[model samples]
Target: MTKPTLYLHIGAGKSGSSSIQAALARCAVPLREQGFLVPGDKLEPDATVSGHQLWFFQGLPKDEPESQKKVLRRLLRCKNAMAEQECHSLVVSAENLINRRKFPDLFLDVDKHFRVVVIAYLRRQDQYIQAHWQQWGFKSHPDFDDWIANGLGDIANWDVALADWEAAAFKKQIIVRTFERPKLHGNDVVLDFFNILGLDGKTFDLGNTEQNRGFSELTLRIAERNRDLFDGPHDNRFFAFLGEHLGSVVYEKEGGSIHLGKEDRQRLLDRFRAGNERLRKTYFPDQETLFDESNLPDRLELSEAEWSQREHDLIWRLLFAMHRRK
Candidate 1:
């Protein structure tokens, strides 16, 4: 019997991971028939989401060795189950796995039984930070400067993140791909991910599904003001209601555009310029730059008075929305 192969899509998040995972789940039966099993979908605690967050959580470091021992046992059982089903390929999709410093160590025992492949998708630093900033605002309002200096700012520096994953993967090749559409194999993320797995894109039924749309500027303003009142571990329902109903409202309003200033954006680009160049040369040698910025819309700067007026209007809308909900 041939040994099974395991693919790890350990992510640099906000890189269309949710969509890819959803597609994987949609095609799981067909993929299994084709000898590929996406076990992550089944392992997710919430059937609606398509990530193996529980597996990632199990492997996250804890103070006690017992937790690690239990995780290893669970992994062993999972592998045995896959083998019994005669599945020759298993995919583990978890964006959070990249944050686990002991990434390779988590699978040292499993490697002895199967082939391990590590794959990652990366976006340009400029685009990555912009998208991440929007996502972060959904959960909490953090000052962009402080957020950059602390939370997500360092994540876009691909050189550092990739290097860390490479070191953890031991002898395995870390297959890296750019998230830019033109650079992607099929110019579609789900198709691109499947292409890497040696599957024909035509075989899968990918639906028109959108996941985790970020908060708009007006929504962000409301979230910033009310975070202390309603933000907590169990408030995703409230956030979802705001995003689904009000995200578009913000876009239609005049002067509602909220984004980093040109100076700040340029500073972020400059900070990552040298690192991005290195990454392109190392992974994507065909590209001149990690990102093509010639087509980006010019930033629209709002004066203090304009911003204040916008905020006052947005607050009214927020309060009205809340009152209606009640």
Candidate 2:
């Protein structure tokens, strides 16, 4: 019997991972009928949010030996079940898996059972850093300079992050997709992913599920100022509430915002230029460039007075909105 193929969507986050996961969860049954198994539907039936997060969690270094064994057993059981059902492919997606430097070690025992294909979406470093900072760094570091200076920029280095997988024993193929809209098939990550799976995306329900929108500039500045108050596990709740209430207000007023200036964007792109070029040549030789740079934002320089006025107005509006909500 031919071994079932296992596709791992190891993410470079700030890409549209959440939406893809949600889509997979939503279409689990239909996909199974088509001989593709989303393991979370079987392994984690009661999970509120889907995707094989438990698989990744159990594979972590901190997990107990017994717990790891349990997950592995469950995975084997899933494979057996898939075989019985004649499912030829299993897709496990988790954005955090990109950070696992020793990625092959996690699947060493199971590589023989499946042809493992690793898939990742690479976003431009400048946009990735800005989105990542807004999503996570603003809570702790607040200042973009401080956050980037702390070596967080290294996360965007796809060549380094994927080196272990490139040379792993489980290497069936590595599919690297550009995260830029123009580059993606159908200008959508979900559609691009379905295309990768050899499925017509229009066949699926493809609900209007948008996930993880970044905070606006005004909200980010306020969150930065109040970073000290967000020093707990529930900080995400606070950020979500602020974003839910105030994210649109700034957008309505300012049209759109650009977090990185032209020079900063250029500097970041330059820092990763060599690695990115190597990646482009290795994975996508047909493409002229790894990422399109034609539409990059021009320089943005805000005067102190302008910043203060924007902040003051945003705060007053926030206060009024809160009162109205009550």
Candidate 3:
């Protein structure tokens, strides 16, 4: 009998992964009808709503041998169930998989059973860093420059990060998609992913809406200031609450969010120029550049006076809003 194909979506985070996962979960029935199995539904029913967290745990630290064994057993059970159900394909998605250094060894059993196709989405490094800073870095490193200087920039080295997966013994192929709006199908990541799966995206129920919402620059600043209140950087509930309440606030001040100056942005890009070029040649030979840079703006740095004033006004507004609410 022919081995089933496994479509593994290893997210380079902040790349609309949540939206994709939600859509996949919602359309589990439709996908199974088409012979594609979303393992979460069969192996862990609750995971269909929360995402493929079960699979994600496999990439966690190797200290929990029992937990790892449990996950492996569940995966094997899913594989057996798929065979019984005559499912020819499987889809397992988890953004955290991108961080797994031992991906090849971890998925050796999976590779033995199914033909593995690794799917990943890559965002421009500058945008990625900015998004990540807002999402998690603010809790630990309030200053964006400090975050980058203190080794966060290393995550943007896609070539280095994906090299191990590329060379993985079981990988049949690796699909690398640029997470830019223009590059996506129908200007949507969900549509782009369905296009990759050779399915009609319009037919699937996309659920209520998109999964994650971005934080405004103002909210990020506030969150950074109050990061100590949270348990840790992963204290998503606090961050989400702040964004939900303050994300839409417009300071209407002289300066916008703190962004890397033109020179600094160019330097950051230049730092990874060689590796990006190599990636472009190897995966996207048809394209001249790995990322489209035509629309990037040269944001000016805010003067200290302007920044201080903006912060003062923002705090006053927030305090007044809270007082009124009470």
Pick by lDDT: which candidate is best?
Answer: 2
Better of 1 and 3 by TM-score: 3
Task: Give lDDT tens digits, candidate 1, residues 1-326.
Answer: 56677787877677878878778778877777887766553342213435445344644557435545654665556567676777777777887666555655566566666677888888766667776765653355457667677666356777776677666554346788877888777787778888888987767777753455544555555566566755552366656665555566654433313566556666777888888887778777997887775655446566878868877876687788877777
lDDT of 3 by residue, 1-326 (tens): 68888788888888889888888878888888887778663344224544455345654567655545655676677677677777787788878778656654566566667788889899888878777876777777757777788857468778877787877763348899988888899889999998888887888888754666566565565567777777876678865544434444642232334666556667778888998998899889999999997666566466778767867876776677667667
Count steric clashes of candidate 1.
0
**Candidate that would win on TM-score:** 2
Error of 3 at 210 (Å): 3.2
**Across residues 11-47, which tens digit of lDDT does each residue of candidate 2 receive?**
8777888878888888988998999888753353223
Ranked candidates, highest TM-score first: 2, 3, 1
Q: Please report, in order, the local distance difference test score of every candidate based on alpha carbons.
A: 0.66, 0.74, 0.73
- TM-scores, all models, native as reference: 0.80, 0.86, 0.84
**Candidate 3: where are CA atoms >4 Å away?**
41-48, 58-72, 170-172, 243-257, 300-326
| Residue pairs in clash, model 3 | none
Error of 1 at 268 (Å): 1.2
